[model samples]
Target: MKNIIYVVLAMLIFASCEKPNKIAFVNNGTLINDYQEKKDVEAKFQLKEEAFRKRADSISQAFQEEAQKGQTEAQRLARSNRKKAEALMTGLQQKQQQLQQQMQVEQQQLTQSFQSEIDSVIVNVKNFVHDYGKTNGYNYILGTSDAAATVMYGAEQSDLTQTILDALNADYKKE
Candidate 1:
């Protein structure tokens, strides 16, 4: 019984002497926004959005011109053939509706694609941070943002946002 007590005491002392856990935190918003890959993705999507807008505008302008021409022709026909003019106006209206629908579908598709790419980049950043923590012997790595302060206060030395950002940017450049 005495030996058992001594053994338990020894184990407790040793456990108490063990090294403290390694913990760090990064600014979630900063890390994600400053990541090189994320910036690149945003730039790419911006260009695509601009191009889509230009194309949409061009299509709209051409359709407007066509509609103007059709209206003039319909007016001339109405002077002699009222039924034919009514049919031409109906056809033009249907064509405009179809064009608007097509443009809307195209815009929706582009938005979805852009959102998917952004989601992918966010996932990649999270995975990279996870790997970095594991590789660097971190027991815990917390993320904090202005919206949700999971880590309200941490020592300046414990803030790893810039370090992780640098490493992430370097890795991106390599890729």
Candidate 2:
């Protein structure tokens, strides 16, 4: 009777020790910084901005040259041309405003997309980590990458940033 009671107590203790998994980490900053998809979007936005500036400069230079040529007829024509230039400048200003708005929208959308992609990958990795922890019987699994004090010392093997970035790029390539 004593032996049977001890055995049952041991079984109960073992059962109580078992649990499902919970995972936490600090991959958000790393995901935004290292993600290739986000980098490409930024590059395209820069190219568009540079092209817009060049076109605006060319228009302004043409207007200045016309103003510099001084004859009575030329002055009269310049006055008329100046009004036209002013109207065109207004239109160009409006276009620039529209382009800036478009760029903002694109930036917002790209941010949302990168977030969605990272969330999905995090979910998959969480599932994997849960399995890994359960199999290894780790009651607590911590991401040293998320540690404070400048991440003083973490094994490169444990960083997991490169691994996650690779997964991100692979998913991007598939798309």
Candidate 3:
């Protein structure tokens, strides 16, 4: 009977010694938004967007002035020279189309450039998170954002947002 009791006690101790799975969660919104590179890239893109808008506006204003001038000359010519005024108007329309096409091209290029850069930044952050989990012995790392939370309920102790963010910032500084 004493041996049976000892065996039961040993089994209980061994079971108690087993560690639970390591898991943690990071706030996705905080991680992405607070990241320095993301902010800097956004600022740079905003400046580029503003400059392009200004340039397009200037071109548009010049085209408007030319249209107004053409209108004035057409009015001065009367119905006898309607054909000449119509031809001038056609030429003005072509110029406006060209200006619009040019603006569209510029906007597309800027958007692609910004999107590619941001995508790369996001990939880097994801890799950092993966490595962090592997190095820290976490079985899984959950992400929570405003849109959705991979981890619906977790203890505050299981939150690793600050730790991951600090590691990420440190990694960025080295680069």
- Candidate 3 structure quality by residue, lDDT tens digits, 31-122: 98898889889999999999999998998998899999988887776577888888877888898899899999999999999999999989
- lDDT order, best first, reads 1, 3, 2
Looking at model 2, report the run of 10 residues with the lowest lDDT sum: 66-75
Candidate 3 off by > 4 Å? 1-19
Candidate 3: minimum summed lDDT over ten consecutive residues — where?
Answer: 71-80
lDDT string for model 2 (53-170, tens) is 6765675576455435433334465576877556555655575567567656766766676567656656655565455556655564455444343455555554555655676677
List, residue by residue over 2-44, the lDDT tens digit for candidate 1. Answer: 9999999999999999999999999999999999898998999
The 10-residue segment of model 1 with minimum total lDDT is: 117-126
* Model 3: per-residue Cα lDDT at residue 34: 90
Off by over 4 Å in 2: 1-15, 20-24, 69-159
The prediction achieving the highest lDDT against the true structure is 1
How many collisions per candidate? 0, 0, 0
RMSD to the native, candidate 3?
Answer: 3.7
| Pairs with steric clashes in candidate 2 | none
Give the distance in Å from residue 164's predicted Cα in candidate 2 to where it truly belongs: 1.5
